[model samples]
Target chain A: MLTKRIIPCLDVKEGRTVKGVNFENIRDAGDPVELGSFYAQQGADELVFLDITATNEKRKTLRELVSRVARHINIPFTVGGGISSVEDVVALLQNGADKISVNTSAFKSPQLINELAKEFGSQCVVLAIDTRQEADGNWYVYLNGGRVKTEADCFRWAKEGVDRGAGEILLTSMNHDGTKKGFAVDITLQLASLSVPVIASGGGGTMEHFTDVFRQGKADAALAASIFHYKEIGIPALKQYLQQQGIVVRWESNENFIC
Target chain B: MNIVIIKYNAGNVQSVLYALERMGIAATVTDDHEKIRSADKVIFPGVGEASTAMQYLRERKLDQVLKDLHRPVLGICLGMQLMCAYSEENNTACIGIFEEKVRHFSAAHADVGQPAGEEPLKVPQIGWNNIFHLKTPLFRGVHENSYIYLVHSYYAALGEHTIATAHYGLDFSAALHKENFYGVQFHPEKSAAAGAQVIRNFIELVPAI
Candidate 1:
């Protein structure tokens, strides 16, 4: 049976992982590559590197960080944030990024999804949709790191993205992102109707939240950041908990560290 | 050791290069005919549309080079698909190194994700799954049920050349071997320890040419 994946998200700034990540044993705690290695050692099924470094020099640092992380870890990882063109996707894929996530650019040009999926195959293209529930109780698309709102509805955009050749959907609820209350199972379950594997992101608070996203949300994978970074939850422990609860997951033990 | 990874328009070549770097072996990723043929060990790794990838190889005259390689050749993912005779993907004619055909998963088995007498058809069998019925030196140190990463919409039907089989919609060749030529549908480079073992085994298979 194919096990549900537990992915840890890392925010990279200026080529290093942001603050508050458990870094006791790492020689250079700031390095994103080092953090990737640590998570790989802890049995993270896959890792997501979000380059949030807001600078004119974002390209050089993020590319270097991806290269370093690629050289250090063997597991697959996705690079997201500020990816606007096919050139950017090519550059990142050349740097050893298994997949590239597109959000704002994808919305700006829906045809970009078809172009990318045509050139690189759908498996390599992930449509990262950032959605937030408004006062009308209907989820709306947000762009520019959740600052700009778009008229596109979440469900319709996700369906159109898939039809445009997106193999996976990384749906994140902005309202639930920093809250950590729980995954937006309502939206996730609705998004799953698209039939291309949905990666439920944002508001992954506890182990129960993960199981809920998998069982009720019907998410093929769950991605979280702060929970895994703050040491409040360890990947190995969470996977074990899911396993005990009859949720299929891949868990590599300490003695068999691949790194 | 001169490890040459055949580089063309195919995607995911960088991951293979980095995998070798981690193994402490500097590998040259190139499409040079002489470089690919002369290298002691050749790794043909690919990711992309089969027809487009094969078209790129044909234009580069690599079609003949890959077919005539005398040394140990390892093909991963789409590289394995191209080693076959034909692929349903874009109806492409391949190098015929494996004497098999690549095909998209059957959608006949509907009601895929429910508990029924039949299983739903899942294409591109992404993520990690275990490979069993192992044979050949490629899987020497790999455990029978150990998981490896795979991401493909087409698969080569089981044949005499099959070295390992993995299940999704149905059992297909996870790894296939015919003489010096080896093909793995899964990405050993991205498959962690068990996958590392497979790469290590392939590198150690020959007694220095």
Candidate 2:
């Protein structure tokens, strides 16, 4: 059995880490390099850094930050935000980002995914989709920091993203964002129908929520921030709970614990 | 001495670097012929479509450089596949270091139980699987039925050079070992500390020069 992944997402703005409620009301978190090391030490499977600053100059700074973090952390890290060109993707990868996530750029020009995949290989490109449910109960895609609404169906875009050579889909639920209720199971199930691996994000309150997303929602991985950042749950204990529930995890050596 | 990782559009090189650091060895990533040739050990790791990956290697002239290296070299996943004579992935030719052909797992096994004549198994066999029939140096201190992580759609069928075996729809080659060149289908770096130990074995095998 393959082990399920537990991930923590950090939104980076002006070199500082921030967590927003429903992708708004950003509060100061801490320095990304320091927080990244902390999460890696606590046994995070992967870390995601979203550069929410939305400026060209900040872009350069973000790449440097990625390089600094990669110096110490031994786990995979993903960088997103204001990425509009292939050069941007290349810069991040060269600066130590294992994977690059594209949301707004992916929607603005669909060919961006195919082009980037062709240049950097599909496994290095991640299509991050942010979706919100409409009055008709259909999930509509949102872009540009979730300020623009598109007619693209969430499921359709996911299938298309994978078809365009996206190695993985980072599906975040705007409705569930910062709610702490749970993940969007319906959306997750729909995306999973495409045969491409999907990571469920938004609305993770507790460890049980994670297990539910894995078992009921059928997500390949779960990404959360407040839960891990606020010390509400530790990764080791969470893994223990998931293991008890019959979820396979890559367990580290307790006997080999260094210091 | 910095261990040089040959970066030719391969996957998991970063993870391999992290895995090396976890074991107290620092490595530098490079595709430069001189830098890689001068390193104590070189690792070639990859994931993704094979034909395109080979194209990238050839475009950078890494194909020729890899063949001429006298240092200890380890290839993982698609890295192992590229070391073969040829690959069925997109009907691509590869470095003929190992006389093997990478072939997709036949769908014939899916119909094993069906009326005596139907493709029975699935392609792109993903997830955790067990490997056995190990050789001395790589499988050293590891059990025969030790489980390893795998996420490949195609596999190198068992041949004279196979070092280990695993069953998907049937028994297939999980690893290949030849003179000076070692390869494994499963990622030892991503396989946890046990996997990390295999890397340690490879590091220890580095001729102490």
Candidate 3:
């Protein structure tokens, strides 16, 4: 049985974690490697490091961070943000990143998805779609960190991405992102119909929300940032809660063994 | 022990190297025939299409080098599939270490008894899944039904070489063992602790005489 995945995403800038990660025991909250290993220790199935660095040296910084994370963390991790070309992906993968997520670049040039899927296997390419529901009640794809909206319908675009050989879809809803209400179950449910696995992101405020996404929305995995970084929800407790809710998750009996 | 990872045109060998480093084992990633043939244990790791990889291996005659190894050889993911006799992927012929055929996952949902309105088993079968019926020394300390991470669309059909099994719509070979060759469908490097344990077990295995 394939267990539902729980992922904690971290935003990185200049090789340092940018978000406020409120962990008391952590010595350096700014270190992406430390935070990533911390999450892996806490039973995070996987980690995603979105390199938000917008400078000329972003690639070098991200590569170094990726190498450090791979050296320390035992589980799989994906590196995204500012990944535009095959060279960028090769650099990251060579540095030990498992997968690379492409959003704006992929939307800008949909062939980028095909080229990546060809160069690396589809398993290594993750198509992240940032979408928002408009007044027309139709979800539209958003680009450039959710600021610019495109004419691409979320559902149709997702299918096109999948057809282009994207092995996984990371669907993040802009409207519900920070609202703390719940995940965008409606669009997520529709996107789950695609052949590839769908990872629902944004708007995960509670453990029940995770259950809803996996159960009702049929998401194979759910990704969140702040709720986990702030210590509001511990991964062990969340896994336990999901287990009680009859969701199958990978449970590590000896959590400290990895340490 | 002199450990060498046979490198052709595959991805994710870096993670395998890091995993070995965690166990304090320094492994050499090389396609050089001398290094691989001289190493006490050889690891064949891959993540790519079958025909293309096989073509690369054949072009360099690494296929013959791999087939000629007398010591223990371990294959991961695409490496495992390529160890089989044949693969439906691009209708490619693979090394004959394991006498099974690798078949692609079909979207047919009725066979799995998936109720209508339920999502069919996703291709690539990403995330963690348990392996059971462990038989070989490869899985010595690993617990049965221990979840291991996997991401692939094709699987080797269960046969005499199967030492472990996992289900995703049907029972398939999770791990296979022959005279001196071992192949696992999962990425032991990225599977966390239990996966690490599998790697440890492989490292500790005495090379077959």
Q: Candidate 1: list runs displaced more than 4 Å.
A: A19-30, A53-61, A252-259, B106-122, B206-209
Q: Tell me the tens digit of each residue's lDDT in model 3 across A37-126.
A: 899888899999887553224343368778999888878889888888999988888898999999888988999999999989999999
* Position A145, candidate 2: lDDT: 68
lDDT (Cα atoms) of all candidates against the true structure: 0.82, 0.78, 0.87
Q: Candidate 3 at A240: error in angstroms?
A: 0.9
lDDT of 1: 0.82
| Maximum-DockQ candidate | 3
Tally clashing residue pairs in candidate 2. 11
Q: Report the C-alpha lDDT of model 2 over B7-121, residue by residue, as the tens digit.
A: 7765646667767876789888889999988878878888777898899999999999988888778888899999999998899999888898888765434433433452233
- Which candidate gets the maximum lDDT versus the true structure? 3
Task: For candidate 1, write residues A75-158 as lDDT tens digits.
Answer: 998988888778888889888899988888789899999999988899999999889899999999987666678988999999
True contacts kept of 1: 0.56
C-alpha TM-scores of all predictions: 0.92, 0.84, 0.94
Off by over 4 Å in 2: A55-61, A252-259, B7-39, B55-65, B104-153, B157-175, B186-196, B206-209
Ranking by DockQ: 3, 1, 2
- Model 1: clashing residue pairs? B112-B120, B124-B152
Which candidate model has the greater TM-score, 2 or 3?
3
Best candidate, TM-score: 3
